[model samples]
Target: MKKLWNIGIAAATVCLLSLLNACSLKEKNVAVLSLDKSFTTRSGFEGLLNGCYNDLYFLYGKEDFVAPTELGTDLWANVGTAGAGFTLYDHRLVTTDGNLKVIWGSAYSTINLCNTVLYYGKEVKGYTSQAELNAKLAEAYFLRAFSNFILVEEFGGVVLRTTSSTVEGVDNAPKRSSEKDFYDLIISDLKFAVQHLPVNQGLRGRVSKKAAYGLLAKVYLQRTRLGEAQEYARLALETAEELINHQTQYGATLYTSDNTRSGFGKLWAGENNKTNTEFLFIQAVEHANGYNPEFWNRGRTRQFFLPDLGGRGGEWGAREGSPLYGRSNSRRFKPSRYLLTQCFEPSATTADTRFAESFTYKFYANANKEITNALATTYKKDPSVVGYVIKGTSAKATASVNFYTQTIEEQTNMANDAGLAVFTPNWTISTTDKAKMPMMVSDPSDLFDPATNKYKDPAAFPDEVNLTNVHPALKKFSAPLYAQSNQYWMGDFSIIRLGDIYLVAAEAALLYNGDKSKAAGFINTIRKRAALVSREAEQVIAPTVVDIDFILKERARELAGEHMRWMDLKRTGKLTKAYLMQTNPISGELFDASRHTVRPIPQSFLDAISNADEFGTNGY
Candidate 1:
């Protein structure tokens, strides 16, 4: 027998339908329960209401998990097996497709759950905490809008469900809502949430009024509602700037330079929630169910480092090898070359400290651990710095120079330890392999095998890990300085940051005030932070007015790989054009632009519906 699940319509739908009829029996039941529910009670109605909160995990954690954002835009590099399919636009994914479906399905699932809660919530009588109940309800509204934002952006129009469709004879098939209407609902919900939610949250992961306003600004920006965008952006700036300016302990800050074991590179090292203020929404990594970093490291029995396939190590390291080596089964996300390059002036020689801070390829190696020297009853105190040399065949060759000034035995040991000889072109010491450097510590350091190693005097030792690889490891989300491999619990992912908002405001001022200098100032501000020579020095950059097209591209360069790429492209009607790299794997060719912009709606949805016309835009 075919069974029909009575999933309720959205809260909006209930309100709309309520006007047509005074109060249906089902509606009365829900309304009565809404007014009677209690936060502390374990009643059936309260449990269902609590279920609405569960929708948040699905909304923030799984639905838009870092993959889509990372791959959609060019901010992140796709080095692992998981990225190959998504980055290239192949839907043959076991995990990602499931993630997409969860995003799609979870939105509607929560809508129904919210509908039930709101309906029953209105009628419930568990009193004394009206403020708490209202706050919770407001959160529910914000989540529903947030979910819809993803749906409308990814798949376009979606069935605007508002109330539970539990009644046996109630029509379950709802028509697709227009995009404008969808945004309208989203804005309305966020506005209401801002009014109701507290500015501060007791828990780290919970959303606040500031977050609501911040998201509202984003929605307005996407809709091209400049005035509204400005208003929301200003509100967000006011709310968050204070917290940031105070330099409160709540927010996370990167250490540009530090020598402690828990230094700049190991930010994501521990289970401690150190930087929560800046993180608006984050996926929590459970104590036992944390991410696996070992799966991506090199020379491990479990997984050989990058450029290697399966058990056989490859020529170049795979994209994620540096950060994940010697770690657990999980891996860290890496920003892309396009992202790094975009922040700089088109000229390679451009100087920008802000851009420089994004990455550093210089360091002083600790002599004790990296290598050893034998001299008069004492070894050299530290390992010498390995300077970076760019001596590839051509400027674009992207190759590193191998400076070999070592004895045959020293070179041979390194090669043997890495399962490859020192003469091999791609054999290089990685950030994780710093401990393997005999010169990074005392002369007779723990890093070297004394029997086969030379540095004998244990007196002198080196102090920092120097840069050796052409591609330096990222410091952005590194595990904190002292954490062991398995400590990567959830850290906050900033969907919106103060830096980006400044850019947005600058663009808005240029558009609204015709002040090109304002926009240039905004771009320059970010550039200055990146340690790059300011665009101000370039005559071409100063006169560059904030054209919509320029702003869009700038957003791509600045925010690529952060998960906002596809939506921005879609909003600007450039998704198809930007996907110039959407190519086929087997054939190794680009996909037709017309067929690549939007994915076909799930086949199952079309097949289940009796009339395809009723569903919505079929990309027809």
Candidate 2:
């Protein structure tokens, strides 16, 4: 089958406009491709709907929406100097920040596209039947609701624009709607979607009826979190169970562990990545077809998880550009020590495979492979680096360099391994013993202050702490093996998956009624999938107890880089300094719950609208 995202190119030929009638709206300040032109043909209408999802690539593939959702939260923190402004929540995170502007603009643009599609959908021709037309309309509904949900979550109660921002229904100086207004449209949209969306769209990145049910469950739960209504928890649980119980019918199920690869590992890496049955909603990109590099616009989101593994002289810089360690740009975000220490619990007897699957602990010697493809751009070779000739992709590493989270005993024995370079362990090691070792071993004491959960300042140490140099290489996104480049890489970004739905079910069950037993059943399913070989039973909970906090931690463990951390903390009323100090303490102290919970509305947006005074800077 032809890939879904080639809609724009394909539209030019198959869905040519019979008549061009573009309308301008003062509100959006962008011309809407008139529905009359779009609905002239079924292919044209399909192109219009797919255009609604095209904005998703701009939002998801870039740092705009990802930073708003992931940074300043507990699971992830800024590395080096790039995101300190937003991560620390200081003067840099103000309304004028480019990222803030991008978030607000991209969302509204997507919403406008959906509104246009829905407004003139009935006029669409060449549909085989009412069922086909309803399914198409249902997709637009999901996109509109999805975009609005992001708006409401990021910026509280926004101007509700149900009508297309075209000449047909122009409302130039619209005032902001209440949260109730947003949820009403959102609920209505999803209910319509659930009634009409097909069980299987048979295309990656498209939403299904199961996706509608899943998202509705979350929407209701969010309403409860916003203090809108408490009775909605029942609805949330019921909707979540509707999707959960009918997984087999919907052709979705959890990936189970095989002898060779764990389910969690298989879910992200290997042959089944883009086609994984678990993925419900995604921003999928087909290889080569998705090679448009509008100044670094490729899906380099995987680069966010890596350290700046730049070239150094010794084993520390052994593999500066290996596909195994994966390529990284200077702007990267590493996992918090709080996330590494508190959330993951891997024991020798009952190993947690999620810890291993999510992070990369070892660095292979870079073989300086030639980048033949022009699109696969990489950093230029550094003069001072010590990389070897190309070896088999997975050949043995001559040296070991890592930021490993290990037991003190494991560290002590591993410290004896030959050619161990730049060893930084989480557990404490003695200062005297460190000097005697052949390798440049780190004093685990210098890793972080156990009291504060903050990393030690580089200036405070005798040897400057290589904070950005040899940290763990995050591989959950599983950087592509063949064509390596930080400039552009085609990787699929998952927005919703079955693993998250399982967590939602557990959360709703506990929140709706204190059904700890019911919550345990849902959570244990995810834990079992993450458990190591022969230890699935050890990962099980006894159904003795569960709570909102436990659900948040499990989410952190399971879906860290999938981008929903800041919202998770805020939704559960745990965005307080107390919670941050205990968990993500670096910026936890810098956070001000008074204003930090809600991001400031972009200055560009405020300046653009006639009702600027009404939509102030969100108390910025």
Candidate 3:
């Protein structure tokens, strides 16, 4: 047992947990009631089930909860550093850390709700069909499995709570279960989900049979090390192939051609987030209201890994209107040097459509917007001396423009599409071209120093402007409309999608056997979809040889900030060391395999438990 969270259950506990916001039947996204119903009617049963799903919003969209998953990963670091700092394993990452407490408490709360559903669901009688009743129960099973899956992966070898927390005190089950026990329960629940869950849950964002299959595939791949590693890999491959082979049956298709007006940018272009068929499962939010609008307003997936664009005076529009620049969020998880250099520079010879789609390569201007020197300096505006921020100055760009891309090439005739700011970290844009361009330019030399893990000397820009102001921004979850006052970018968060499934299938085959060709084929399915149409052939892997390293790299390129990098590294034994090591540098620098794998048991939970000494902190 790495850690134990005494899921002390009581009526008061259930009531207190229920007080949190959840999906409403009135909304278009995930819908259900607050579960005031006693599960006597069909609506009551569904409401209770939906409440179980609500916890996901607490984890996924919430900032503190996301810190553990994204901040300490290989692909991303703090917005200013070359590698991760505190979240990796600094002293600040303690047992009393609020983020850890929130995670442990939230997961157990969701599990308790599922347990409550299983206990009282039989009383729910208004079923139109047997499948409906089965589906309802299956959803409960899946939700429980999902929460426990998070528990095991995060804290390791947790107790499997089946029955509702009916007692008035702590759950009597004290001993922590084995990792195998946790997976057995997870697999059993998911198998039931596969058997009963419909292809379409009918409501948008509801988990389906296909969603269960995708999740099952990922679980098996992670479960390889416990025992029967090869067999688990085979099961993973088999399950993932089911989705890959017959995606149409499950109402899914990968966005292959990123070519229309914005090229690969169409995939995450905000307008198409709801209609993106490639999403197997997502935390889809409505355009207007998501969950309880006011309370859930903090639920955000925007501006993280995004550079401080707001600081650059209103080059990009303010976030109140549509087609505007995304709002200034507390941007965390800056891209690591590895991600910028090794990962997405057209990894193959082909023009990788993903680089343009994965990031925001261009920024537009906000014409006629007033600027103040004081506001400019307060905003930490880069190039504050420019006309855009300082006002009446001649340095501001006037139109939407890009640095290296052909969208807005050259300094001449840059009328409707002008460049206010350009970020060309990899490109060696010549001084002549840069001078001719109308915007402030930030190349690799001007931004944060990867080797030093520090921002470059700011003497080049205005006293208020620092080079850290310029870097690549992740636009995958960007939604400008979702960024108004009281609105965090509440767009649909793609949890397990078709792109990730292809990689799962690829990795599973290679792990099951040395089948590089089969793995390459699976990977190419995604690569081709991510490539420029004519150059698709060039994006294909040679298939001569493939290994875990290649698979890991592909996963990083495809699924970098999708809330599972830590698990990917952990499951593969790649998480080791506590400081910079030659083998694992960016993410795993502070990852101590012994203690860092499983987080510390929340002290609040420990304080409540009677067997405190017997069940000590999980080696924190």
Candidate 4:
């Protein structure tokens, strides 16, 4: 089945083989002649549908897919480095940006593949049973809707091509469809998927009936129709409730605090087992073909969140026993100060396991390496240094500290004694005035003293704290295999999870029915898990009134680095006000809401099509 799926994906990449039969003989006999074939069997149709999944995996796994959604949002801030993501974060996006081009091309290309499957499935024979045919058709419908949803969210009112582009000149230049039309099509397709898709597909990556309902809930919520949104939200809630009730039957369950070692931390720590109840859909990545660079099977998510200076050779390098013992090639995005502090209640930072689990504040030196006094002076300027060694003699030596852990402090003191200059980026302890410093001591008694306590107001912390080399590292997607090699790590990317569904339920209840109590009930489920508190103790951590802002903040805290922020902000009409005006450090004031809500249609796309000039770009 895997071999057939691989062959199908390769064949689909060449041309829509099934659709080539409909093209003119002159055109079909040219380059597409060898590949011209139709999927006559149910297995063949299933294989073609698998090809669509492959394309989606490739599209979603790329850094570009993450950047457009995550970079410019309220939760994430750029690290003052120039890259493809800079334009997205700063709202300086031009139509020619390669990221924009890739997203557009990949999404439409996948859509075309889906169209081929759906169009040709009507004539296909050799179905062993009717259930098999319906399943294949349902998968195709789901992929088509998913691809169209991606297009609509990023580039608004995009050309909605429902049929295959087999006849080159006829269907090549499609005009932009209405946003209403696009939504209607998505809703229609998803409804069919929900009706036909089974309860379980027996695979983690494959879409199930629950996934379809979940998507419909999202789709309805995103559209302008409030009544429909409420209806679908109700449907989604019922669907989620069904899944939650029968966990074993569907092979799904929530990652509860009591059973899991890390509680909320277990979700992202690469512990995606077969019985993982949280994951609704995951992009199953394999280390097949020995890390093929061209294939998107290897995950690069960990690289985006990692600080560039903390990889292998840097001062605060990744070491063997630490949580951050992984390869991090780039620090493209960092958590905004608002997210690290303001998003969570001050008490939640301590009580909530997510705060500690999500980020790494301490770094260790894995090897014995020297740092010159000049480089130390440039990176960290401290006058106390007098002929420092600046080398780690042992792996246990704490190289750097973002938080004020006692082990780190003792290590720093040792470095100072040994003339090994210690570098602290955003914090410092004054030996003379102990009253001012925010210290994190191991002893609980030290927390009571104002002199040795955590920083009260992280928002008031200096802007320099957000720099690439010194910011708090996101440790959720850390890949240990990439520690020594340049090749990116192979890890599964989760599309939707039970935690996300809980939040979606909360949002839907709040927005659609204005049922704050029910929304709170849903929100409490996740909050309780986050705080490691029981259902009865949830009131302490859960919000009393479920508002849009609170839900958005909760989403940020729960779903950061998962690539869902921009849509959350945009869907709730909070993008311009919350993200563009208030949150973004670089382009906060410059973001024009009307112009920047959706991306501009790529210039190359407009130039290729003759009717595109008449259709115009996405408000470019």
lDDT of 2 by residue, 542-589 (tens): 667578878898998898877788878877988888888777876777
* Weakest ten-residue segment in model 3 by summed lDDT: 1-10
TM-score of each: 0.59, 0.84, 0.81, 0.79
Q: Model 2: which ten-residue window has the lowest total lDDT?
A: 401-410
- Displacement of the residue 68 alpha carbon in candidate 4, Å: 0.7
The weakest ten consecutive residues by lDDT in model 4 span 439-448
Angstrom error at residue 109, model 1 = 2.4
In order of listing, the candidates' clash counts read: 91, 0, 5, 2
Q: Which one wins by lDDT: 2 or 3?
A: 2
CA-only RMSD, every prediction:
14.2, 7.9, 8.2, 7.3
- The whole-model C-alpha lDDT of candidate 3 against the native structure comes to 0.63
Error of 2 at 470 (Å): 3.1
Q: 146, model 2: CA deviation in Å?
A: 0.6
Best by TM-score: 2
CA lDDT of each prediction against the hidden true structure: 0.42, 0.66, 0.63, 0.59
Judged by lDDT against the true structure, how good is candidate 4?
0.59
Q: Of 2 and 3, which scores higher on TM-score?
A: 2
lDDT of 1 by residue, 1-620 (tens): 00001111122233222211223334444552352334234254445544554444443323234455445443444444554444555554322255565565556656666665666557655656878777767767777777778777766666666765432212334467787788888888888887888766664445666567556656765665323544544444443343334433334333222223221123223333335433444433222222211111111211111221111111111122222222222333333333444433333344433322333222121111212233111322323323211111111111111111111111122322332211111112344443333222211122222342211223333443211112322333332221123222133334554455555555555544556776676665544434312332432356365666677656654454345766665555554533333211211133345544444455444444454566643442
Instruction: Judge candidate 3 at residue 578 and give its lDDT.
Output: 39
For residues 1-620, write the lDDT of model 4, one tens digit per residue: 25535655554653432221223323442343333344555566566667777665555556777778776777665644534343343445777777777777767767777887886688778887877788878887887898788888898887877776643323434667787789889989988897899888755467887677667766766774324556666665665555555655655666767633445866655444333567776666554343232453355555566554443235433332232333455556666556665674434225567766777554444343444455334434343432333344232222222111112212333343332222222222343332211111111111112332222232443431222344456656553322212234555557777787778877877766788887888887787777554432743444465798888888987888776788887887777744554554444545667777788778777665556677676666
Better of 1 and 4 by lDDT: 4
User: If ranked by lDDT, best first, what sequence of candidates would result?
Assistant: 2, 3, 4, 1
State residue 143's C-alpha deviation in candidate 2, in Å. 0.5
Q: Candidate 3 at 585: error in angstroms?
A: 3.5
> Candidate 3: which stretches are off by over 4 Å?
1-37, 80-86, 128-130, 167-169, 258-264, 290-299, 310-323, 346-350, 368-417, 422-436, 448-465, 480-487, 578-580, 583-589
